[model samples]
Target: MAKRIVLFMFMTFTSLVLSGCLVAESKYLKKAEEADALGREAATLQEMHRELSAENGTLKAQLSRVKEEAAVLAKEKEKLSADNRELDQVLRSKTDSLSQTVADLRQKVSDLEDENARLKEEIAAAQKAREENVRQVSKTYEDLLDSMKGEIAQGQVTISELKGKLTVNMVDAILFDSGEAEVKQGGMDVLAKMVDILKGVQDKMIRIEGHTDNVRIIGNLARRFPTNWELSAARAINVARYLQSRGIDPAVLAAVANSEYRPVATNDTGEGRAKNRRIEIVLVPRDAP
Candidate 1:
């Protein structure tokens, strides 16, 4: 019985020890399973974090591109605004210049009108002076004609009064020898008195005219003179020169010869021939006093 009890105790101790070892092995297995599950979960979380980080980097690049585009648009808008302002300034300057030009044109037109009025006044004054000059010239000629008429009526010389002009006839019998251009002493005295009368009239033009009969000159006198026309011309020129020497303006004297061309009476009679050979003096009114 003592041997059996000892064997029984040894088996019991073996069984208890085996039981504790088995429990410990089970606990270790459970802990290993929990650790494996936790490790798988951690690996999944790491993959998800890597993917999120890559997505965030892509979104940040897109935002940067959008901000660059916005900045370019803002610069373009500023440039357009500056161009519009310059155009507006140019338009305003052109409008002001046009207004000033229009005002200057109006002033020039007004000045031209004033100048035209002054020219009109000057022309009117000149016309008035011309009219007054004509009136004075007419009165002076009429007075001289009347005085000459009175002298002719007193039997000193023969004269005829005509419309707007006068005529004087100096007969050759009273003034010159037959077929001669020389004037007698008495004829010279008469001519001198007429010269004095003509000198009193200022600014008068005087004409001395000589005439001849149809009778021809003969001998050396004919060769020297050629014709009665030449003799008559010489006589008229001599009378004109005498008048010029007697203080008459040379501009006022004219000489002409009419050789038996113009006659007041027929050349058939001796008395008519004598009347044809004569000298005449005419006075004309001048434009200036």
Candidate 2:
């Protein structure tokens, strides 16, 4: 609207200048009034020009403020973009760390499960071994008890079963005469029967242990025997040799002596002393050694 007014005023001023050139004398009749009117119009034009100039200045100032605000907004947008990029990087790093932690925890749980399974298998194997050992021992004890029934009833032998071992307890009088290390004929018969049963048992160890009463040797018997320890050892060795000669495996046999140290009865009485002098044939697992 301001531009149109300015253009209209400029065209009117040009027309007035041209008319003055052509009709300088034709306007003589109301020249004063006309001149006065022209003066008023010029004054109005000047006022409008001043007002337009002031408004142009105000618009210039407003344009400068708008440019400054736009520059500031551009800088703020750049800052926000940079902050978003940094936040994205941080979030990605945190996600990777959490994923790695989860993987490690899963591996730990797997290892623990594997270990638990291994322990269970070991426990099962141990239980099986114990059961097998018990079965073997029970079978050996039953055979010994059945075969030695007559001797047991006559008080010559006793059979005992405990743990994983079988023990056949025989009185010294059943194997040897007084002051003798050689086994009697009756003892050989008993040993022959025992050997028949033992040869069938392949996974057992046989040990012959001899025990003697605390009695000092005297006379020719003393010269032949020497000491109680020697007598006891000789008796055990003799029993082991006899068993080996009777087809019992020598690899499964061992001999040992206990001179008055492992007595089953008191030496204060004759009956007790006789009971204390004894022999033990032990059957144990082959792995027991």
Candidate 3:
């Protein structure tokens, strides 16, 4: 359009110049310059519009990609929420189990404490009973020792107390004849004194242990007592029977024989043989079974 306007103006100026109607050259040149300037401005406006349209297309593409990335991020967030919920359920289950286990451990600890207390009480009771038993045995030992001081001084008897057991040793000559198992009058009197001292004994067993010297049975005596074992056994039994008859508790009585064994002295000499042929009265704890 600007070119057409410039062409029409040029023709009009030529017609005027040919008819002798002259126009100013400055005005005509100024109109041509103004037309060229308008054309240049129009071209610049169209180029700017094209560049703007391309930039708008690029911005639209970028917006579409940004929206797609936002959708993917939303899906990931939903999946993460589901996974977190599952983890929470598992954690709660484990926590509940741990709580119950801790409670059971606490209960077991309380039960053990109760059991420990019960054991302590039982041990205390047992200790008290043991102390009472010791006192009872000590009194019995002192009383027997005082009452038999004369026999103890003459070496006819020896009294000993060891590890809660009390023992009284008497020679065979004081309790029996040369080859007899019978208790004589003097022996009965000595046993009567022992029975009096031992009457108040509690929770104890009184055992009569008879020992014989290392002498073989021979002559007429061999017929009835074939060996020292038989003779010693018979003598122990007789002494136990006599003590039972003298107000001692028969339930606490036991008889044992040591024939030429468990001797306190050797049987080679006459004095040692006399010491070996002795009876022992022992106070001991009762067997359970």
Candidate 4:
């Protein structure tokens, strides 16, 4: 019985020791699992920290680019402002020069206007002097026409003095044919004598005045003459042309026509109608006061 108790006690002690070792192993396994979980958590934290650092670096790079862009924009703005100031200065200088030029031009225009008025006044004075000289010379011209009165009467040419002027009336029968502008052969001698008398007059203006009776012209000859007025005008022009061809100055000659307007006598009478168709050569001073 004692030997049995001894074996049993030994078995009981072995069981107790085995139970303590199991408890220690269980505690060690729990500590190992906690360590493994801590390691995983630390690895997760490290990954998160790396990602944050990379994002921070990217943000820093973006900020640096933004600062560089801002600096470039600022420099461009300054350059533009400087250019605008320079342009404004140039515009001001040009405006001042233009204003000065306009002022000078206005002064010049005023001076030119004054000079023009002075020149006009001087011209008027000179013209007045010339007219006075012509008036004095006109009396001598009239005296010469009076001296040829006897010769003019013999040639069937009548002379009359009116308003200090002489009028020579030559009939169409003595000067031209019917509806014709040609001067007759006998009229040539009379005109030559008159021209000779007028040659002595200084600054003489000669006018050849023509007149015609009222007659409607028709046919080829009438087409050339057109009307009595045209015929009279042509006759006067022809006489003036003849005088010019005979060495008379063109400046001294003037020709005109009057158709049945300046009749000294009545047109109802044939003799008065004949008298109405006439040519007159008038000698006058070029200018008169």
The most accurate candidate by lDDT is 3
Instruction: State each model's C-alpha RMSD to the native.
Output: 12.5, 12.8, 8.2, 13.1
Location of the lowest summed lDDT over 10 successive residues in candidate 4: 136-145
Model 2 deviation from the true structure expressed as Cα RMSD, one decimal place: 12.8
Task: Estimate, for each residue in 16-46, the C-alpha lDDT of model 4 and write its tens digit.
Answer: 9999999999999999999999999999999
Cα error, residue 30 of model 2, in Å, equals 40
Report every candidate's CA lDDT: 0.73, 0.89, 0.90, 0.78
lDDT by residue (219-241, candidate 2, tens digit) is: 99888778888888999999999
| lDDT (tens digit, per residue) of candidate 3 on 49-128 | 99999999999999999999999999999999999999999999999999999999999999999999999999999789
For candidate 2, give the lDDT of residue 45. Answer: 96
TM-score-based ranking: 3, 2, 4, 1
Instruction: Provide the lDDT at 229 for model 4.
Output: 81
lDDT of 4 at 131: 70
Off by over 4 Å in 4: 1-151
Report the lDDT of model 4 for residue 119.
92
Q: Pick the candidate with the highest TM-score.
A: 3
Clashing pairs in 3: none
Clashes of each: 0, 0, 0, 0
Comparison by lDDT, 1 against 3, better one? 3
Local lDDT at 27 for model 1: 94
